[model samples]
Target: MIDIFGTLGPKCDNEIMLKEMFLRGMTGIRINLSHVKLFDCKDSIDRIKQAAKEAGTTPKILIDMQGPELRVGDFDGVVSLAKGYYQTLGDEWIPVDEKIIRAMEPGDEILLDDGKILAQVKEVKGTTAEIYVKRSGGLTGKKSIRIVGKEVPMPALTDEDIENLKFASEYGITGIMQPFVRNRDDLLAVRNQLQISGCPDLRIYAKVESMEGVENLENYINDCDEIIIARGDLGNAMPLWELPGVQKRIAKTCREHNKPFMVVTQMLSSMEKSAVPTRAEVSDIYNAVLDGATSVMVTGETAIGEYPHEVIKYLVNTANEADKKIKQNKTGE
Candidate 1:
């Protein structure tokens, strides 16, 4: 069966929602740790396992770990940037790490919200820098920022991740999804850390999100239990039009290496606001299964969407269609 995973958040965090999801074909739950602390997630984890038992289905827990991904700091609401306006980090905008901020040179391009908004550096002054907006755009705050032509230095596992690792085994987490995993070294480092924390059995799912991860994809395929094409941030690394090609290449390589792979992002994006999904969303999920995805996931749609369960219904139905076609071909029916 296609393992359908839903992201656990405010909308579906209780025992009832967890049991309801499993009853409707969900196979696992993904708890994202980017915003919340690991220890803070303990209650949710315990509740999930208990809910699984109550539902009579053993759903695996997938912890989404923040790894080496740089993101901008927060603001009240939508901060609008006009052309020729100045951006003073820590004042007008919250600052990211100095390492990432200092890496940008004058005239260097910076893409925010996955390249939807663009900014350029005009000057750098200590921890503060002034930026010139290429065009007028609005930033909703705390989105991932990509610096063009520079590699922002970040460690494989964060300090909080290490702190949380001490009890991953005790909690019995089935998998940990590492984001921005560029090469084999990241996989090894995370694996070593997990073992040191006494969670040697925890599976590693590599999230291929940047150009660096895609270029060095082969080096880490063997180390990863699952290869996830993070289509959202991955596209920001290169031209957006090339994303489909990049997604296919990664999925193809994973298949060649006999690795379980998945294509994520925007599978049911429309359903986040509407009860119904678009035709394109249906096709995207169907094609992902046909491309040999061992599992498919719904992130925001299940975590915070208005139609959480409906999103799963759409995803499961599409995956089932792919399975039916495959069975027919194998049996010549």
Candidate 2:
């Protein structure tokens, strides 16, 4: 079966809605720890457990670790970036990793909020930089930041990530999804933590979200339990036009190595607001299965979308149809 994993969020945060999703064939739930502390997610975890119990299945609880990812720091309501204007990046105004600011050069590009907002460094002054907004969009707290064509040196795991992995070991969580995994050593660090926490058997799903991760994907596939083609930040790591080919190559490599991999992010993005997904979205899901994806995941669509169940209905239907076609081709029916 093509396992389906839905990100837990506000819309499907309760038992009733979660049960509805489970009944519709969702095999697991992904708890993203980017925006909230792991200790604060007790109620959410309880809700997932209760919902899974009522559905009569053992659901996989995967904690998405925020490992060495640079993000816009905490803030209130969204900040609007206007085109052709300068925005300050510092601890006071728009908080970001000082390392990122220090690494900035006049021409370096910065992608914010999953590449939605684009900016370029206009000038650097000591610990901050003046960023010229190239593409204007709303910026939210804890959203991602990426510098084009550059790999910022960061630790394999953050201190918070270590604490969270230890917490997951005690909580019976099924797996740990390590984000921004760049090399074999990244997975090794996670594995070491899992061993220290005494949950060494927990699956380590490496998220390939950087050029380093892509260049070293074979190491990830060989060492980690699975590969997550996190197209959002991965797209930011390279030219947007090259994303499709990159995804295909990753999929092919995973299949050749007999490793499981998932295609995630924006599967049915339109359904986040609309009640129905676009035809192109359906085609995207179908073709992903045809490309030898072991599973497909929906993030914002089910996590905070207007039609979470409807979105899964479309995903399940589309992927199942693709699976059926593959079966027929194999059997000569």
Best by lDDT: 2
- lDDT string for model 1 (138-213, tens) is 7765677888867787899988788878878777789999999989999999999988999988989999998889
The TM-score measured for candidate 2 stands at 0.97
The residue pairs that clash in candidate 2, if any, are none
Cα misplacement distance, residue 318 of candidate 1 (Å): 0.8
Error of 1 at 206 (Å): 0.4
lDDT per residue, candidate 2, 248-306, as tens digits? 99999999998989999889999999998889999999999988887899999888898
Alpha-carbon RMSD, candidate 1? 2.0
C-alpha-based local distance difference test score of model 1: 0.85
The residue-level lDDT of candidate 1 at 47 comes to 82
